[model samples]
Target: MNWPPVPQVDLLEGLHLRYGVLATELRLLSDGLDEAARTFRVGVGNGPDLALRLAAGDPRPVTYFVLLHLRDRGVDAVVAPLPTMTGEAFVRVDGLTWSLYPFFDGADGWTHGMDVQAWHNLGSALRAVHDVPPADAVVPREAFDVTRYDGLTAWNAASR
Candidate 1:
């Protein structure tokens, strides 16, 4: 019996990192990383790192970039500081980047009304994530070996 199986990922060539990158980028941007510095392979996640996977390589570095963006922001809302790269980021441990934050107790999983408090919270989080500012950090595009992070797709299992 196989103790561990190969990763289940995008079959279409050049699309493997699409979803993960996009999702990670959104989460980072949403957490406020508009001009944040990015570092690939900063650490690992529950599964294979995204950037590396997309490059048809190893640990995706871009995922760590997103995590680093979030972590640099000073908001520990999600996970603790992502596992360091040991070389660049410096990690004495081996694990995921973000410290898995506890599940938020939303009013409902199916749906939530646009109440005043909800609106306030939404605005607050949005503001926090979207409020961009000037910074010395810059991630050269040439550094990332994959396409820029973008797009979101609804998953469908039937095709598989």
Candidate 2:
């Protein structure tokens, strides 16, 4: 799938510098990845900058939960501007990236208001996903767990 062009990493690096993760600094990382491989495979339209900022300097549990939960549910389908996660790193999607999804013919955006069946299906999906037992997962906490109001926080190399 061909994705639209993305902005430079420096544009997001400023934002990432405010947070902790480099999902914001997509340009440089994106420079190496094939746009075709990174689409939908990368950050779905949730805007990696926002997700990264929200996840930055938080507890290991939150980070683990958010990332794991998103992965468990296949966030690629939900987030519009999919951000690609190549191992631990995340880069923005580009035209070169591609993923073969089961073709669903339709326009984008919500087509219906809340329906009983839709709610039920959403609930069912969430329940099933949550039921997946957490295995022996290790989320080592970083040293600067606390994030201040202004944005800058200690990114201790201690936490991995």
Report lDDT (CA) for all predictions.
0.33, 0.37
Please give the distance, in angstroms, between residue 116's alpha carbon in candidate 1 and its true position after superposition: 2.8
Q: What tens-digit string does per-residue lDDT give for candidate 1 at 1-160?
A: 2212212231121122222222222122122132222223312334443322111223444555555675578544423232322323321112322222222323542254576877786677667655544233534434664443332222334345
User: Candidate 2 at 34: error in angstroms?
Assistant: 31
Question: Where's the lowest-lDDT run of ten residues in candidate 2?
Answer: 94-103
For every candidate structure, what is the RMSD over all alpha carbons to the true structure, in angstroms?
Answer: 17.9, 15.7
Q: Report the lDDT tens digits of candidate 2 across residue range 19-127.
A: 2334422312222233333322223244422322111121234434455455565554333222333433233222121212222333322544666876787787677
| Per-residue lDDT value at 92 in model 1 | 16
Q: How do all models score by TM-score?
A: 0.31, 0.31
Query: What is the alpha-carbon lDDT for the whole of candidate 1?
Result: 0.33
Error of 2 at 2 (Å): 36
lDDT of 1 at 67: 51
